[model samples]
Target: MKVNIPWVVGLTIAALGAAGLGGQTARVPGSDADPASCAAGSGRITIATGNSTGVYYVMGGALARLVNGHTDVRAGAAETGASVQNIRQLVAGDYDVAFSLADAADAAVRGTSPFGEPQKIRTLGRIYPNYTQIVVRADSGIRTVADFKGKTISTGSPLSGTEAIATKLIDAAGLDELDVNRQRLDLTKTVDGMKDGSIDGLVWSGGLPTSALTDLYTTLGSEDLRMIDPTPLLPEMKKKSAVYDTATIPKATYDLPADVPTIAVPNVLLVRDDMPANLACALTTLVYDNRQALGAAHPAGKDIRVDEADRTAPIRLHPGSERALAGLTSR
Candidate 1:
């Protein structure tokens, strides 16, 4: 049974140099220069997004369209390894904006492991939440994390928020990384593995109704696939980071028998601390103002609400984003 995933149609929508802004100064953020004086110049900018099948990629495309249609910024969304990598490249000036998981963003700003030194980054705003989806073959007899000791599992792409949470969840379950055969594959490959019985399970942190998983369920059905409740590790997960919370994946999301309980982490759109104030302001406003259009692309976009946009903490909001939000809420 072949399923057509609409989102993958134009996967590589635009290249980093697609907008042709060579030689000229790229609007790379993170400098001590006064953001107020920097004009919102007309040029191409890249957005670092996640796996092609994940919500970040879908929403990133939608965002790029919004920016292009409404502002002077010529935006392009690139598929990346997600959170950790996105933040790293965003700092290096490879990309102007990035979508990152809150926990990873917190680690980046605090100079924690996986990050060599503290980074100077600021949030456009908190967008949606990522629910940890742990799916196992019903025939694999993997009832809990402990059962994963001898089974093969896909832990998500390296340097991704999915990998970070997968590792923490395994540790919280009292299993060493050596206990399981870990595979670091992206969602597309992981789904392929699941289809062929080469992979026993997969741990993915993504938005509800992730296109890849939807494809998986559509092809494999409930008789062969199932999601596990990992809420038991919430206390342990929270001990390491306050950002960890519990969320439910409604049975309807993938047509399961019942709701699945899992760990949740908020996602944020990050930009360098030194981004021009006006550019940041315009981008932030464009997102909220065109919320309906973004939502039309993916359900996750609807979750990006104005009321919850400024909830990003630890990582300060960009001054321009703050100005945008201030004006938005006041009206």
Candidate 2:
């Protein structure tokens, strides 16, 4: 039941700095100084990612490595409660960058309920999508979200994006949170609960090939565990946020018996608006240019593409990111 973080996270990652991306002097918006020339002088930044078992954590580490290796920025990745908490802490200056679900990021920008006021956060870019995985015990007699009423379910850690989406999925199925026995636990505990029969099902939002979920299916066997189709509620979910889309959990993934229909939401890397432009530009450049290093770190990193970099609508692109991408485009 233990979900190991692929790599140890600490001060060491930040201390191992890399030379700036060697090239022309940078002309990013905030400064006339060449970004490459300032590599050694850039400040340290932390990337907030999700549970250890999830894609964000793995890729966040790869991204930190990219920045640490290609730019002057000293970066570290922190395991966090995902979207909601990542945004809150990022805005509070607890972290320099954060990985967030698009819906949660949209809510933060719109001054939604969880966000009391509109936040001044900006996106570096949209990376990949988090497929909503709902796995339940085959014998639990639950085939749909509606069947979750009065049943014990793990909604992921409190304040995590998984929790937010779990609640939404419940409502989308015309069920109320108050009617379900919700257990707010981390992936490890949730897996344990599932194995021990204390938990009926769980909701997880992560990139394909999530390690924890793989362990669950492997341990329980496909015949013992089944994935519920979330497609039935997609219409209702989309009504709440355009970020929701239908996605497939391929049969090859997790070795499921068949492809499972599910919902997915895009993920975005965010930073506060005031982040130094040069550093932001360098960070953005590192993420896109040396993405191979990131992909080597995690498969999800391969999905961080240039075409989707500017898809962060509603939330404006960070000036640094804008300047960085502009440099790429001009080239």
Q: List the candidates' TM-scores in order.
A: 0.91, 0.88
lDDT of 2 at 36: 42
lDDT of 1 at 210: 100
lDDT of 1 by residue, 1-331 (tens): 2222222223232343444544555444323334553234466667889999999998998887776666555667888999999999889877888999999998999999789899999999989899999999999999888788989999999999999999989999999999999999999999999999999999999998899999999999988997989999999999877888989999999999999888899999999987888788878888888889888999988788899899988889999999889988988
Provide the lowest-lDDT 10-residue window in model 2: 21-30
Best by TM-score: 1
Please, what's the RMSD in Å of model 1?
A: 5.1
